[model samples]
Target chain A: MSKQELTILGRAADDACCQGLASAPLDEQRAADLAKIFKALGDPVRLRLMSMIASREGGEVCVCELTPAFDLSQPTISHHLKLLRQAGLIDCERRGTWVYYWVLPGVLDRLAGFLAVPHSAKEPV
Target chain B: MSKQELTILGRAADDACCQGLASAPLDEQRAADLAKIFKALGDPVRLRLMSMIASREGGEVCVCELTPAFDLSQPTISHHLKLLRQAGLIDCERRGTWVYYWVLPGVLDRLAGFLAVPHSAKEPV
Candidate 1:
């Protein structure tokens, strides 16, 4: 998204926060956009890929370092990385031929805010 | 899972925190279990269904009230509810003909914790 469009979307989201969910059902376009992001996270490989990127020291890790960590082929790892980048959850930079990945802070936070329960929840049995 | 099994699983998860995602690849059973839970969250209908439940004022909401909030049919809402319940993300209780659902705290916290980055992250560009 362009910086202008993202700002508009964020402002709209903030404005619409607690009108309750269906007060503004995620319109079709928003639903599709959100679904693409979640679909990227639905796989186990992507989940772990996200964690590795998010939790790595310096808040990022190199593609070479990531590949050997999984038993899967390098190509498979590359494919998952591609999905993460597309989802807007992580960003990559090319350092020569090797790429590095880093978590986009507040991306996960945005998701958590979407799922957040009211602060008043009681302990579950 | 039996209470015993659940406790054991919980303990193992606690014990294994931050050895990093691959310091132990989620063993097959754990991966399958977690994947099922995430798959339940992968859909927009289900995600909104969960949000409605978690954000309800009483820490729970009745199924009857939940159904009307969506454009979907009662049965369709019920199907999404079943998926959430199966994922153990929410619990249901029947009061006469109405069933109420409540969020399972620490469930989302567990997921948030899984996606959690280090306590320190600089602002993203």
Candidate 2:
């Protein structure tokens, strides 16, 4: 599901070019698509989970390892992970008794590219 | 109010270095602060408003000019703009009948820098 979403998101990102948000006004459809991804990251718990997964060494982390870091319940953490996956920011696999998650390659940079302001659009310092 | 929030956000961004989210796990406070900004952009209406302001020439747009672009009422558009301002993404000033808005100098770039996964973190293509 996320892989499919990522493809759609990739096309949206491509349509806007490098400085997506700042280069031109966004049309409603593209804005709606991007907004869903941003909304997924809007929660503090999800943001923390994203950072944890994104910064993990060796590129992925087990669900067993992730749950211990937060005071929230396992289900709660899993819920956050689900939202991240739905946003196309991360993907996971069930391995034995646990799920392992990794940041989807290039998604973060694509999001960064989308949000970045071009030099010409920047205000004079 | 937005200026004060911008200063605080700047400090948070500086503390994390260039590869903020990908370099290390974010602490609770920083995650909360960054989440608010992302949340502000999470709505399609607000996202559209942000792009319209950020992409405008001369780096600013009048409330009058912004209103006609959407199907929303002026007050509804103003509410979304208020959320953007509260997130420290934009600032505005009233001039007679209209308020003019511009993206806060480097906030978009700062946000992009925070979300960008460093080259080292990228998976081999």
Candidate 3:
């Protein structure tokens, strides 16, 4: 079975389809794929979740630790984690009874690359 | 009216609510506000739109120029623009018949700040 991989912005770095959109129009498939990744980052719950997990001590955190951090229920937090995971922003491993999540650095790095301002480019008024 | 001023990641830098979420759980209001911003970036069309306008020549581009970049109709593009504007990612000005849009550099800068990885932090396995 194909693991429902979450892009986690790590995938986004690899998904260079975004680079073309500015220079030209996006085809349907590309738009859909691109949209899926952005959509993953669309929720505040998920955004905070990603922030928490990404910046957690040891550079990785467990599901048990993440669950109580929010007012949300376990399933809800799990749902958000699922989205982040699918987006490829994070990766998880089963260690004993607990599952740990860690930031996929490469994806975040790509997102930063996309947002980097060209220093030589004239500033917009 | 307290402007529904979209956050545009520009606000994210100032909001500082995100900073706490990593170490602590987010309060209700902050989560909602933060979520709204992420929701705006959630759409594929909007993401592409921001990329187009942000990276355009002269650091600004008009709605007319943005319209043809996607397969969607003008109204759809307009809707996406509204979301971007509300999110504070892009600013729009009425110039005669054509409305020009420019990247809100501050917001994007904040987003980059939030995503910046602490170099001293160990990489996640």
Q: Candidate 1 — what's its lDDT?
A: 0.61
Q: Could you tell me how far off, in angstroms, the CA of residue A67 lies in candidate 2 after the best superposition?
A: 1.5
Which structure among the candidates has the greatest DockQ?
2
Full-model lDDT for every candidate: 0.61, 0.81, 0.65
lDDT for model 3, please: 0.65
lDDT of 2 by residue, A1-125 (tens): 33546667656656654648978898999998888889988988899889998889888899898899989999999888888887777898887887789998777777888888655545465
Q: What is candidate 3's lDDT per residue for B1-125, written digit by digit as tens?
A: 11346443445545642353344445555656656665776777877777777667677788888888778899999888888777767788787898888777566655544455534333354
I-RMSD for candidate 2: 0.7
Off by over 4 Å in 1: A1-35, A117-125, B1-33, B118-125
Worst 10 residues of 1 chain B by lDDT: B1-10
What DockQ class does candidate 2 belong to? high
Q: lDDT tens string, model 2, B8-117? A: 76566556446579778888898988888889889998889899988888889998988999998989998888878877778998778878999887777778888886
* RMSD (Å) per prediction: 5.9, 3.1, 4.4
Q: What class would a CAPRI assessor give candidate 1's docking?
A: acceptable
Model 1 agreement with the true structure over B1-108: per-residue lDDT tens digits: 211234433433343334323233454445445555667677878777776676566667888888987788999999888877776677777888878887665676
CAPRI-wise, candidate 3 is acceptable
Expressed as tens digits, the lDDT of each residue in A1-125 for candidate 3 is 11566533445556542453344444455555656666776777777677777667777888898788777899999888887777777778888898988877566655544454533333345
Per-candidate chain B TM = 0.75, 0.85, 0.78
Rank candidates by DockQ, best first: 2, 3, 1
